[model samples]
Target: MPSPADTLTSDEPVGPQLATPPAISIQDLRIDYGSHLAVDNMSVDIERGVIYGLVGPNGAGKTSTFKALASLLKPTLGKIYLNGHDIVTHQRLAQANIGYMPDMAPVASDLKVWEFLDMFAGAHGLSGKEKSTRIDECIALVDLHSEYHAMCTSLSRGMMQRLVLAKTLLHRPSLLILDEPASGMDIKSRVGLRNILRNICKSHGATVLISSHILPELTEMCDEIGILHKGHLLDSGPVHDVLHRMTGLLPEIKIRLAEPPDMHWKEWLLAQEYVSNILGEDATHFSFHFEGEESDLAELLRRMITQGYLACRVSERQRSLEEILLDLEYDGH
Candidate 1:
């Protein structure tokens, strides 16, 4: 298997330029529905030409934040900027550079796929030849050429999603905000959607903010991730950096034995001075949850060796986004 570092360069173009301003920026944003706060004071910046994963549990305000960014919902407080234009003060300009897909399909079911995209292209000011060219480009971009003449209602869920994406891309927006783009998609459709998104961000220099409940899937596609919980921005940064920061207090060490250790081994692990919990266990394997400075990991390993237990494999475990979110929610209380 290739290392994470190996995957890093796969998506980046050779000699890709750097130093572009953020494509999306949010500062101390807040939103409310009646007396209930749906989005707390949150802030994040998304760089140009990168795919960012906006993740949270249901009711974590993921939809609310996306709506505000798309200018569909007016925020009660805070500001949103897209491609350097303030969304609130410069609504049209900000919106012009954004293509937003809501959590639900917004297509006219009776319209054919091509007509649906053409309608949006016209609305975005495409003229006779320009409209035809842009519509063809979008259809090819989403790999929907075969379904161009199919009625929206006759299309499968996944095809409808692709058509909607084609509609969103009609104006060639620099930034795309997709809220649960894979909600009702099958495995094949989801894979197709992800591939289309990856191509857009990689080949076209477009930035994307995609929200999803599937952590593993997001981890595979996103360049960075922002985790939200209970209306709070728990963490935001490069995926690995955020995971490292969140798990800094707990060391993830895995141990392998020559043979299956006895129950005494579990007791001995828990009794260690720095160890807090035994997170996972299996035959010939165990994971330790250690607290305090990471430098103590060496000392813990030395002690384990000195204790006469044959430790075959010992290494820190990588924290998952789900684990970080759980810790954040529990820690705040």
Candidate 2:
């Protein structure tokens, strides 16, 4: 078996070039199953070397959208472009550039881990020495070296997930679509998967589209995010920009008090004109939601201090991507 470093190098291309183009692009994409329209007019652009998070509640059409992009399910309307080639017309060429791992496990329980990866490498047209080398490279990439010879049935849920990822990388596609890749993983396994995704995006220049209900996990890994709600894309953009837009001009702020405050203080804070909402409150601290001119917030703070409140600490709170998405739903969309 080749060393891990050597295997990594083998999977990367040798030459340098400009304008590699977006790994995947979708425009006004829609998919219908019989009378039900699962995805509705969704559009997105995923550039190379970036991890894009596709997040939504269950049955929000995230899986349907991914299937259309992967060419596993044909769209009822609109177009999909893979590396600038139209998937509708040039499906074979387009598919060659994508590796899709569906939500359900795709592994063959009877096959050994190494054999399964080797099978996909062969399907991608690798032959002889090249095929063997690529299979080894994929196995190493997913850190399945120890379990290479183990039967698929014998591996744990996390190990099986790693094997599926290895299969996806066998073809060395520019785009990877993983639908709930961490579905049944434990905390440690989930973190391990996240690290692998980041490294793949940074080192191999692969664009990854990962859909998950775990908002916090997605926030840490994705460069851009798309939030789908009720089959409509509620918001999609850079994480910080989305948060800023949803909450308007008010900055999220948190304050730590030297001692626990009473409910009276909480009520007073919420009644302030500059404060929009109270995100959370506990014995030691409370977080306030604000929206308005920055100058107005400064005035409110001054008033609080002058009113004889200790106000031991004050800092702008950073909204998580999940918070931003939940806030967007309140706009009556």
Candidate 3:
């Protein structure tokens, strides 16, 4: 993508280039639908020049929160500030600072790629040389120059996604809010989307708030992550911090045996309170996530040996961050 830092200046006119505050800020934000409370009083601050991943199960209020940030949904309570302007009171400035993309967007089949982009540029208040330059920049940024003149209907799903993103960037908004951007994308398309997002953060100095159910992908791509459930934000922080907070002393131990274990061994292992996500290739070896004191683990192993499980070796291993996060969810229950 073209470095908007140099080519584009702040839309501010009367004053010199002023420093922007944290890209997004929410204080005691609450959203509701009729009698149903969607998002409770949740507050979060997101910095610029990085990706923030928001993950939660269905009906977790992720979409409602995003719509409020995008100014599409009115919040029943609290304040939302974008680029130092209140989203509700300073609607124009807030809108100018945000580029929001929903899970699904329209791509007119009858329009050519450049024409589609040109239409958006005009909508964003660009004209003449600036419009042409911006359209070209967006096309090249998403690597869509080859399809510059191609019809929108002829593009693939991945191509269409990239195109929608390009449309979002036409105005050079300081914040990008995306909801399930990679939904239904194939592996190749997903990878492409990831790379593009990374490039935009580093090159454009934009703040991104993205939500998805794909835990591994978010773990790999985001600088910070928030876990939400039932409209409540349970936790939010850097990836490592969130993982550590999930389990103060949790450890994953792999067990191997010289011979097969007794029929009741599996049942006994599951009956223990601190065991979960057991994985094994065969009867002789297995691993499970454990959250308990070291002495408690040893006691369980000793009991297993006495019960004829016949554990030959036990070693510790690292589990996926998502696995640990899941453990936290279960613990919350």
The model with the greatest lDDT is: 3
Q: Please provide, for model 3 over 1-333, each residue's C-alpha lDDT reduced to its tens digit, 9 standing for 90 to 100.
A: 223432324463311123756788888889989999999989888888879998877787999999999999999999888876678866766677688988878898899999999998998889999999999988877778899999999988878888998898899877899988877677776787788788888888888999877778888989998877778888888976776565446567899987987777677898987888777769798998888777988988888888778888998765465675566467664
Model 2, C-alpha of 199: deviation from truth (Å): 1.7
Taking all chains together, each candidate's TM-score versus the true structure is 0.83, 0.80, 0.74
What would the TM-score be for candidate 1 when compared with the true structure?
Answer: 0.83
Model 1, residue 54: what's the lDDT?
84
Q: Model 1 over residues 1-333: C-alpha lDDT tens digits?
A: 223433334344322134554798788899999999999999888889989998876688999999999998999998887876668766776776789999776679788888887788878888899899989988887777888788888887777777788888888778999988877777877787789888888888999999986677888888998888878998888888877776766667787887776668778878887887685566888777777565677777777778876788887777787776666556653
Cα error, residue 318 of model 2, in Å, equals 5.1
How far in Å is the alpha carbon of 190 misplaced in model 3?
2.4
Worst 10 residues of 1 by lDDT: 8-17
Q: Which candidate model has the greater lDDT, 1 or 3?
A: 3
lDDT of 2 by residue, 1-333 (tens): 223433323334322222665777788888889989788888777788889988876677988888888888889998887776677666676776688989876688789988888787888888899998988887887778999799999988778888898888887777899998987778877887888888888888888999976788888778888878867887888876665555546677888777766667777777888686676576867787777677887788787777555578888766676666566556565
Best by TM-score: 1
234, model 2: CA deviation in Å? 0.9
TM-score: the better of candidates 2 and 3: 2
lDDT on C-alpha atoms for all candidate structures: 0.80, 0.78, 0.81
Which of 1 and 3 is ahead in TM-score? Answer: 1
Error of 3 at 114 (Å): 1.1
